[model samples]
Target chain A: MIPYAELLGLSVEPGETAPTYVMPFAVDVIGRPGFLHGGAIGGLLEMAAVGALKQALADEGAVRIKPINLTVDYMRGGRDKPTRARGTVTRLGTRVANVEAVAWQDEPDRPIAAARMNYLIVR
Target chain B: MSDSETPAGRAFDPRRLFGGRFGGHGGRLGIVYHDHGEDWAELALPYHPDLIGDPASGVLASGPILALMDMATSVGVWLKLDAFKGHATLDLRIDYLRPARPGRTVIGRGECYRITRSIAFVRGQAHDGDPNDPLAHVAGTFMAVEGYW
Candidate 1:
C-alpha cells in the first residue's frame, strides 16, 4: 500500500479532535486570478477525505476502502494562500463510512469548501 | 471574434453554424464551431471578466477551461462520427502544469484517441504557450449514449 502522504501530496498533522491536512496552493493551482480553481479544490477535498478514511480504518485494524461517491459544496472562493483541510469520521459501519471535511484559509470559522463523502470498505 | 463561418463552408457565415445560437451560453455553455471540416473542428470562448478570478494576478478561470475541454472533446467525437451522439464523462482528470497566463484567449484542440460502439477515449492538452510542454494535460473517457441528439 502507498503511504497516505505520498498518495495525496499532503501530510496529516495532529489536530485537537481529528487530524488536519495542509494543501499548499501554488500558482499553478489557481483557476482564475487569486481564487483557486473549483476542480483543483474538488480534487484536494477528494484526496483528503480518502486519506482520512484510510487513517480511521487503520486505527480499527481494517485494511482498505474504495471511494463510492463524493459531493462538495463551494461555500466561498478560496484565496491563493496555502489552505488547511480537516476531516472527521461521522460514522464507521462494518462495510461503509461517512466522512465530512472542511477547507479554510487563515480563519477556521469561514470555510472555503465543505464536502461529504461515502466510502465502501473492502474487508 | 467575427460573425462569419458556417459548418458547410459555403461563404462560412457564423449565423448558420449550429442554428445561429451556437455562441450563446444558455445551452452547453456557449460552445460554437469556429471552424469545422473533414478532419477537425475549432471552438471559441469569449473573454469574460467574471471568468477572470484574478485581475491583478494573471490567470484564467479553471471552470471555463474544463467546460471548454469537455465540449471540445465531445465536438471532436461528433465531427469524426458525423452525428451528435450523446456521451457521459466517466472520469475527467487534469494535471495543472502551469497557470494559464492572463490577457490571452485559451483554446483546446481535442482528438479522439479511440472510439468503439460503447465508449470513446480522448486525450488532449490545454496550452497558453509551447504546446510541447502544455500548461495543462487532460485524459478522459466518455460513455456513448444510446440515443442520438
Candidate 2:
C-alpha cells in the first residue's frame, strides 16, 4: 500500500497482471447514509493508478510522480460493501503517463466508477 | 418528484447541515464549513502531516483537495436548488493549477451555475490564501435521483 493510501484505509489484493486495491466501507468513506463518497472512490482510483504505474515503470529506475489532473465519472452509487479498484496504464512516456482506473463492488466488469488521470513523471 | 411538491416541503439549510462540523470523509480529512451563499458553498481544509503527499515537498495530496471540492459543490447544488434532494455526482473534473503551500489552510468554493429537471452544472475553485491565484479549478455535474422539482 502507498503512504497516502493508508490514510484512506486502502489495501492491495494480489492479481495476475496488476493488484486490485480494496477500500472497506467505513465511516471515513461513507456519504449520504449508505453510499460511498465520490471523493473516496476518486482517491481509491488514484492510488490504484499510481500503484499500477509504479509497477509498469519498475524497470525504468527511480522517478518522481506528480499528478497533473484527474477526471472521475460515477456510474452507480457504491453500496455498503468493500470496493475494489485497479488501473491500467494507457500510455507511459518518458515525461508523462496516462492512466485509467475503475472501481467496483461484487464484480470487476461492472464498475461503479471510472477515472482518467494524467501524471508528470520527473526522472 | 410530484409537481405538487412545494418548495417549503424540500427547503434546505446548508448552514444547518454543515455548520462548522464534518462527518465521514470530510471529518477524516478535517474539513470544515467555511462560508456559503444562495448558490455557493465553501469548505476549509487545514494543514495536517498525515495529509501530505510528497514528504520532501511537504505539500498536501490532491485527493483531499478533490474531496473538499466535491463536498463543497454538493452543498452548492443544494443551495442552488434550495432543497436537499438526493443527488449523485455524475462526473467531476479537476485541474491543478499549482501545489498548495504547506501549513496553510486551503479553501474550496463551489458554485452551481445551472440546473435542469435531472442535472445540475457546477464550477469551483480552490485556493490556499489568495483567490486570484487558485490552486485548482473544478467543473462537474450532479444528477438528481429524486428529480429536481
lDDT of 1 by residue, A34-71 (tens): 66655556656665676577677666674666555455
Please identify model 1 stretches exceeding 4 Å from their true place: A1-123, B1-31, B37-39, B129-133, B147-149
Worst lDDT 10-window in candidate 1 chain A: A1-10
Q: Could you tell me the lDDT of residue B107 within candidate 2? A: 97
Docking class of 1: incorrect
Could you give candidate 2's per-residue lDDT for residues B31-108 as a string of tens digits? 887877778888899999878877788888888899999999999998888878889999999998899999999999
User: Once model 2 is optimally superposed onto the true structure by TM-score, how far is the C-alpha of residue B38 displaced, in angstroms?
Assistant: 1.8
Query: Model 2, which residues run further than 4 Å from truth?
Result: A1-3, B1-11
Q: Which candidate ranks first by TM-score, i.e. highest? A: 2
Instruction: Candidate 2: give the TM-score of chain A.
Output: 0.94
